[model samples]
Target chain A: MSERVKVTIDGISVEVEQGTTILNAARLIGGEIVPPAMCYYSKLEGSGGKCRTCLVKVSKGSEKDPRPMPKLVASCRTTVMEGMEVQNITSPEVKEARKGVVELLLINHPLDCPVCDQAGECHLQDLSYEHGSAATRYEFDRRSFERRDIGDKIQLHMTRCILCYRCVYVADQITDRREHGVLGRGDAAEISTYIEKAIENDFSGNVIDVCPVGALTDRTFRFKNRVWFTKPVDAHCNCDKCSGKVTLWYKGEDVIRVTARKDEYGEVESFICNDCRFEKKKTSDWVIEGPRKISKHSVISANHYEQLAPPPVIRKNPALKEANKEQFERVIRY
Target chain B: MESLSNRKKVLEQKPMTFGEKIYLPSIAKGLAITFKHIFKKRETIFYPEQERPVSENWRGLHSLKRDEQGRERCTACGLCALACPAEAITMTAAERKKGEEGLYREEKYAAVYEINMLRCIFCGLCEEACPKEAIYLDGPFLEADYLRKDFIFGKDKLVEEPLKS
Candidate 1:
């Protein structure tokens, strides 16, 4: 086991193993102090420092050399030192820098949340809502690109891509074959397949789950319904290729879309195969589990109720129960 | 019993006077007041023929708006439906195809936007929740219907007519 190091973030001290990044150290203590990451994924290897949303200020460098760093550092990329003191939300400089980073990320990104399928669950949407300014200062025209189909099952909108390369990393690491990659340079960079070749592999569908934005989305669930309108249920099927564990999104009795189960950090618990994602949309395809619990803060939990049990007062009073008969019936229907 | 509020009033039953016992004078007074109102201005108007003025901010029937280019402005993000207190709004979205740019404003639009007048409280929450400035409660009052199914308004009734240009 690696040696443990003590780090203080936002005035709270937590002991994490050595070589652990500052973000993970803060995540161990887990609360509002944890920095918001846009690109860095704990599952993917060598994926950090692309998006600067997780920048934090180091107040104290180390135990032996107790000198503060000159500038802010990316928390995901910067490893924690012994007795290091970090400031995330407590520092105004980090907040201002995150706002600027959000503006830059939204520069080319279109204001198409009304049409985008990932509007309710998009990480960029959450990032901009918290850190971004009300309006843009950019006077020039925003960049745009025509929609392209990467495959028959997955649709790609290059305009919405933030160039985080998370999807690219998924292709390289998770799948056997790597078909698409970032093309062009600097402002003109885009994720594209060479000669528009289709990305077909056992785990190629994991790219859609890794994408933080609506740049990549399931073609089967395209424009079917909004994310909040559909009910998410935890389900699993027997598959020979990949993990059968998935969340089946139900519009009604029919399973409109199937996706890998995502954790609290919005990362998939286990990547599922392409067959489990696109082909198995019926309710009989998988073993049914009860409704998945979504956070009350998320828009996806708008109408979802955790417990359908009637209030005790309703049982005591018959008049109140009579007035609330429709609601009780609706709860039973759900 | 003692009054908690000290607001209880006591009434006395007194014998009638000679003029009150007769009742002729009081009846005549009531007839005179009734005749006086015959020359006064009528408070009620013929509603179908002469409508009363509504307030500037009055929220009436909802109408889906259209852009100056004759395209439907609604992209159907479902915010209005989510914000609806009465749950009157419902819609299904569809992607706009090629050569249909002139008809719809965005890439995805509401294929079947419906609002049940029977369920709607007309609180204007849907108008407030609309991001595209597409739905507004600006039209005149909704008329009464005989059939219950007719109260469920669809796109044909809610959408405003396109500009002639």
Candidate 2:
């Protein structure tokens, strides 16, 4: 086993592996203190440092050094040291910096959340709501691009790409062949397949999963229904190409779309093949598990009454119970 | 026996006088009240010919709005459908074709938007939930229909009329 190092983030201390990044260390101690990352993916190798949303204040360098870093560092790239201290949400500076970062990210990003397929579960939407300013200060016409199809299945909207390169990383590491990559530089940089080549592979569909924005989306499920309107159920099938485990998004009795199961951070649990994603569109294709547990805060769980138990905190505390009396009454009505 | 709820009144019967037994005085008093109301201001209107003015906040039948360009303003984001507590709103979204830019304000448009007036409580939740400001309860109240299917307002009934060229 690697050596262990103790690090403090947002006043909470956690012991993680020696070479672990501050973001991972904070994640080990999980909760609100963990910094928000746009480009970083745990599954994809070398997928951090591009997006500055995870910037954190390093108050203390290490036990031996005892010196604070001059500037805030990207928590996803900076390694933790023994007795190091970091501030994420606790620091007002970090909060202001994050707001600025969100603004910069939104400069070119077409605010088309209403029409975008990734509206509800989109990370950018959540980040902007939490950290972004209400209106833009930019006085220029925002860049626009004609929507293009990556293939018959995937639709690409260049206007919405934040250039996080998470999809490019997915194309590099997961797929057998890398056909699509970031082209151009600075304001002109965009993800594109060379010479309008089609990315046909077993795992090209995974790019849709990794994309933080609605830049890449499944054309089959295009404009079918909102993410919150569809019900997600965990299902699995016997397939030789890849893991058959997937989440089937049901619009009623029919399976409108199929996607790999996503974790709390919106990362796919496992990359499924194109066959499992595109071919299987019926209920009979896989063994059905129960309804996927959606977070209470998410709009997807708006009307779901399956889990009616009051939160443990409310159950334990009298004050909390008194405050949430109406919610408890609602639960009773159900 | 004592009453469970106390303060009961006892019977007090008395022999009636000639004036009380005749009942002419009581009849005259009732007629006076009826005669007084005849000259008073009218309370109701002839609704079919002269309709009452609806309040500014009155929520009636919903109408899908159009942009200044007269293009359909609804991108079919489904926020209205999600917000409809009665689940009255339903829509099928379609991508705008190459030549259809003049018809739709956005690339994605609601191809088939419907609201079951029977199911709709007309709470104006859909109006409040519309992100594009495409939906509003501004049209006249839904008229009575013979069949249940007619109550389901489709795009034809819901969408606003195109502006004159």
Candidate 3:
């Protein structure tokens, strides 16, 4: 440990390690501090400073002191200086600025949280509750965008995107086959491919994982249910080289979903690949496709024996002729 | 882009009246909306420790499924790979041996079934295309990725776990 530096967050003075972020330091000294980072993660290996929620006021040594760094700095991406002061609770200017930022984000963000899959787990919901203003000044028709299916398992909803470029950055870092990038500028700026090309890499699904909100989600799970209904199971992703623990989700007894569980932030890269997230679906009718459409008087017998059978295995020796699914048409159900 | 000077003016701002300066009417209206939300149900969901429920129609991150005997249901039929508009799935089908018949339900099984989840569109087309009833549309709302490679869901990563006796 290097020299511990003294810093003051509000009036509580404490000594934290050198190069610690304000967010981490604040967490260490507990209070009602409300600074947030929609895109900042301390253990995160990458720096996607796209989300601007982490801004904070840094007054100099004294309350009357004038010479200080920029009035606001991103608490997550910025490191703590020796005697620096962070103001998240008492500063009116900073609070007003942050509230404006949240308002702008809500301008384009679909207010579909009522029915969205991310309703219960969304950062927007939490941030608004913490710092967003009670009113929105935007009354004109908000911009709308078509869905961008970047990969087979990932669907992109430009409407929900706050344009935090974590997906584009992480995708480039992994594939070296740079297929996705943010385009345009300011409010119009967005995460998109060079030519709106489809994402074509083994790690395409990670973009969906990194997205802070429901801007990108699995198409299979589109509008299926609210996120809270599914209980997470502490299981593992059984991929070829990695079979790391997965935060498997269960709705009732059925393993309805899976995602990488972060036991240690960035210590173990989420040990799952696109193949594991998708290939499993190739063999079983495990996910109950909503309820079957039956008349009230319909007679049916419950097959308890089939339900009692063992849970399905996720891996198989890759074999069989590749199905030419191109000829298949999308069956639209009424 | 043309500047406003070059464009025709549509609307102009007028000086505020005494009522506007006081803003009592507007303040009352704003308070009404705020009061509604204050009295309405809370919406935020704390994550990692707590998450909301995933509805039947929610499209989320993907995962592979297994059969009653613990055999991977994926036949490596490659329908998912083929059905994928994003061209995300890949596979190498293998013939099952006589002695290892129990290992696979079908004589022809997928020796390799991998989905470039990074490339998957999650259109649920793979679920639509599979004749084996192996695949389905269901999973997590959020996919957390540390490395770009971790987003790639492979066989070892996607396979289901063994049942606890």
Candidate 4:
């Protein structure tokens, strides 16, 4: 086992592995400092520093060095040093920097949360809720692009993309052959399939699991039902390429959507194949275990199970009836 | 005693003429007035078949409006449901997929929009609160139905016919 390094995040000290990133070190303390790392995936190798929302202020260096870094460093990429002091959750400067990063990501993003299939389980939505400003300072027309089909199963809405490149990394690492990659530059950059070839790889559906936003979504489950209304139950299927442990989003008795089951830290342990994600949607196809413990921020659970108040009964007014009768008697001399 | 003396005396000396006593002239005068109205334009309209012109500002049954591009304008934001004082409106929103741009005006469209006509009071608040101008109260009066369930207007009944390009 490697030697443990002690790190102080927001005055809460914790001991983590020697090569652990500051984001993981802060997570060791749990609730003290939660740096929102949009582009980081624990399962993928070298998976962060793309979205700068995880920037933190380092006050003090390790035992070997006495001076701290001059500027804010990305916690996802920066390693924890011995006795290093980091501030992510508490520092106003770090918060402001994260807000700026989130603002930049949202510049060209379409704010259509109500229609987005990823709204209930979206990482960007949660991060934006925690660290984003309500109003935007940008005054120019938002850049828009025509929606593209990445493969037979995946529909890509380039307008809502934040360009975190998690899908590209997942495809590169997990799949046997890479059929799709990001093309273009800057504001025009997008994930595309080469020569319009359909992504027929077995592990192509795992890209949907890695997407932090609605840029890449499942075409079959698109707009069928909101995620919150459907109860996510832990399910499994018999497949060769994957373990088939997936979450089936059930709307009543019918399974409406399927996704890889994420851990408590919001990371998928094993990437499931396309057959498990798409083909085996039937409730009969997989064994359903139990209901998914929906987080408080989930849009599905927000108002899903609450009992609607019964419609109020309309009552007839006795006084109004008597007044009407008196008026009738006065109108006709009866 | 002085106030009692100032009270007006009840007159009892008047006698009616023969024609007035029998009341034939007064009855004939009433008949003449009734007969005169028959020759003039009729005020009452024939039932069902011949309808009267409704006022321009008449608030009647609700109808979901369509944009000029023959697409549904409602994004299903639930603002109309919130604005409904009678709690008559309910809807489920869905994301508009590709090749469906010709059907929905926005990315978010109502998959199932229903308004309980039995519960609606035709207050026009929903129409006024609509930001997209997708709902209006310009439809004719809701027809009477035998079953209560028939009073519930779904998207099929509320949505306007798509404008032909």
Which candidate has the top score in DockQ? 1
Chain A TM-score (model 3): 0.73
The TM-score of predicted model 2 comes to 0.91
Point to the candidate with the largest lDDT.
1
Off by over 4 Å in 1: A308-312, A315-334, B1-12
What tens digits encode model 3's per-residue C-alpha lDDT throughout B35-130?
989888888867877988877777666666777877767665454664577877766556566787656666456666677667777788888777
Q: Give lDDT tens digits, candidate 1, residues B1-165.
A: 999999999888999999999999999999999999999998999998998999989999999999989899999899999999898999999999999999999999999999999999999999999999999999888899899999999999999998986
**What's the count of clashing pairs in each model shown?**
0, 0, 85, 1
Give one digit per residue, the lDDT tens place, for model 2 in A264-288: 7788999999999998999999899
Better of 2 and 3 by lDDT: 2
lDDT of 3 by residue, A249-278 (tens): 555665555565542221224636666565
As a whole number from 0 to 100, the lDDT of residue B26 in candidate 2 is 86
lDDT string, candidate 1, A87-168, tens digits: 9999999999999999999999998999999999999999999999989998888778889998898899999999999988
Between 2 and 3, whose TM-score is larger? 2
Give the Å error, residue A331, model 1.
9.4
TM-score, first chain, each model: 0.93, 0.92, 0.73, 0.88
Q: Predict model 2's lDDT versus the native.
A: 0.91
- What is the C-alpha lDDT profile of model 4 across A102-191, one tens digit per residue? 889888887877567887678888888878899889999999888778777899888888878788888788667776788899877877
lDDT of 3 at B94: 65
lDDT of 1 at B108: 94
Candidate 4 lDDT at B152 equals: 94
| Retained true contacts (fraction), each candidate | 0.92, 0.75, 0.00, 0.25
Q: Which regions of candidate 3 fall more than 4 Å away from where they truly are?
A: A28-34, A43-48, A61-67, A237-243, A262-271, A280-334, B1-165
